[model samples]
Target: MLITGRTLRSLPVLAVAALLSVQLLAPYATAQETGRTVSVGTGEPGYAVNLFGPGEVTVNAGATVTFENPWFEPHTVTFYGDTEPLAPSDPTAPVPTNPGEVVEYDGTSFLNSGFLFEDPFQVTFPDEGEFPFVCIIHPGMAGTITVVAADEDVPSQAELDAEAEAIFAQALDGLKTTAGALAAQPISEQANADGTSTWSTAVVGGLFGPSDVQQFFPASIDVGVGDTVVWESTVPTPHTVTFPAGPPPFPEDMMDPLAEETFLAASGPNDAFGGSGFVHSGVIGLDWPAGQSYEVTFTAPGTYQYICLLHADQAMVGVVNVSADDDDAEAQATPTAPATPAPGPAPTGNAGLDGSGGGNMVGMLAVGALVLLTGIAAVAARRRTAR
Candidate 1:
């Protein structure tokens, strides 16, 4: 029998005997625990796994499940069953959810773990059913949890941890290999008719299976004065190539659905960048009529750094090494192929421009090109009539 603290202190002899008896008769406790843990995000530098480790998990009713985030990127675990999510009042703020509180989720009410960071979001499942959850910020990131009767056997926490580790390890390994291959590619350059040269570099290379990499291929490039660098997106995700004085500026309406069309316009002066002030490509890969590409001509020589605002916290950065001396820059550059012109028709004013006068130049160029095309068409019509 277990004695009370007061009784044990009063009679040491009797307490010792009681404790010995209990210890000899008591069974050894096992290492297995009741609750389950899911790792939120994991990967090396410049790459991240948006997927929840062990995307599928099994648990018994009344058992607690914790979602832990240990990465810089923000993620949410939202359970939306046959209902659409309403627009968030504050784009940067997270939705409300109780941490460490046990809720008997039955798929009727929406449950959200808003902007999971260093803290773990805990919830107890009392109802036995299959529930699906997703990270709303990422398109294909999702998972499922199966709950059964309390008496049914389920995998222990150790087993679940091992499974999640193996899954992320395999996926991250494949992504590392793919990213390295992409980075090995050389920048392509073409000499234009007006004597200026154009250098082309790929943005966010491509997708690796279920993972989408957030890095600039060949993270560093060397270019000379009067050279134009064109960043072309090979992936579908929207990314911006921004050069700022301090931290990059993320627009308040970044997540607003209505700002879709206008958000892709280029910002700052695109005419020339002398390694000063702010320059941004707005949002690239937005299904614009002109294929995903942003150009900037460098006028002065200096070391410049740029980053993708969306993934900068994840170390999605690149370096542009510009040299005033054309010979030195050319010697440093590794060119594999010539870059073709930006495809599709000229972008209209509807593409939207920022207040920095960046869009004005693009609009003027578009109008001039349209007028020139119309005049050429009219002359061709007259020549055909004479024939």
Candidate 2:
């Protein structure tokens, strides 16, 4: 039990080293104990239609799994059997004619994350079995969690991360392709035998594929005040045409029946700010024959920005520039379509946490360890001087 000054100084060094090691291994240790962290939804360009990252995961029994949603929209992680069967439709084509149905989840007896939006939901597995889940809001999105015995081996964090990256890249590419296709379609204007011209554009979503990439054709358009513009839905999924509300108060609910009345009440020319009250088409689901169309006449002359409520974060937005000039006569004589807007670059991996917090924690820990080591060195030097 006699300890030398040199040994005492070395203790601090070892302590600092151990602390640094624990800091570095914290995430992995947590992952092993609480299963793995699967991103519920990749926000922004991809939206929440795509379920868990890696699509599938394996964890040990008695471990907890956390599902984190980085997107602003709400999504659910519900066990597959708990949900109703699909109405018999092609998975590779647009969504089925049926609208999103109500599926209940009580968090137990059924394992579900009711509605997650920018929050992490955790569930524990006590038995060894494969649990398949899907987002009730977007039934097309699915994933599975395989729970094995306590001693079973699972994919490491690096493997899961790599798989997630590849999946996200593919999702982003698909979104860009859908957006580009919709943007390239030319706006059609039918001249009525009377005089007025009806300008129309298709609001498409997964019409040609199984993706939930909703977008407004010709993202931007120019029209004279008083001209009516119609948005026809070609995809099976529902969408909303919502306009921004100016200083005056307006309801934010796009699905409200009163929303259409409010929009019509504000119809006419725009004020100085280019906004004239709020306008929303409510939820426009697909219809047979001609499809569902929502027409709005811009009374005031100003630029109006609108978005599809479901896919706004995915950048499904459109603009309407209303000019003061009356061009009904010329539009009736000869209709000319505007040039298609160029598609923007695909969204890079801007979905996940940018490592700022992790970097800050590491930096702080390193600084603390360095400070402790410096103190140990100073104590050792003092002990040598005393000797």
lDDT of all the models against the reference?
A: 0.59, 0.52
Write down the TM-score of every candidate: 0.69, 0.63
Regions more than 4 Å wrong, model 1:
1-32, 84-94, 97-101, 246-265, 269-271, 286-291, 332-387
The reply for model 2, stretches above 4 Å from the true place, is 1-34, 45-49, 80-108, 204-211, 246-275, 287-291, 310-314, 326-338, 343-387
Score residue 83 of candidate 1 by CA lDDT: 67
For 121-211, candidate 2 gives per-residue lDDT tens digits of 6667778877777766564678887888988788876788678767765775666556556655667666667554557764545432234
CA displacement after TM-score superposition, residue 347 of candidate 2 (Å): 12
Q: What value does the lDDT take at residue 290 in candidate 2?
A: 23
Give residue 337's lDDT in candidate 2 (0 to 100). 36
Ten residues in sequence with the least summed lDDT for candidate 1:
346-355
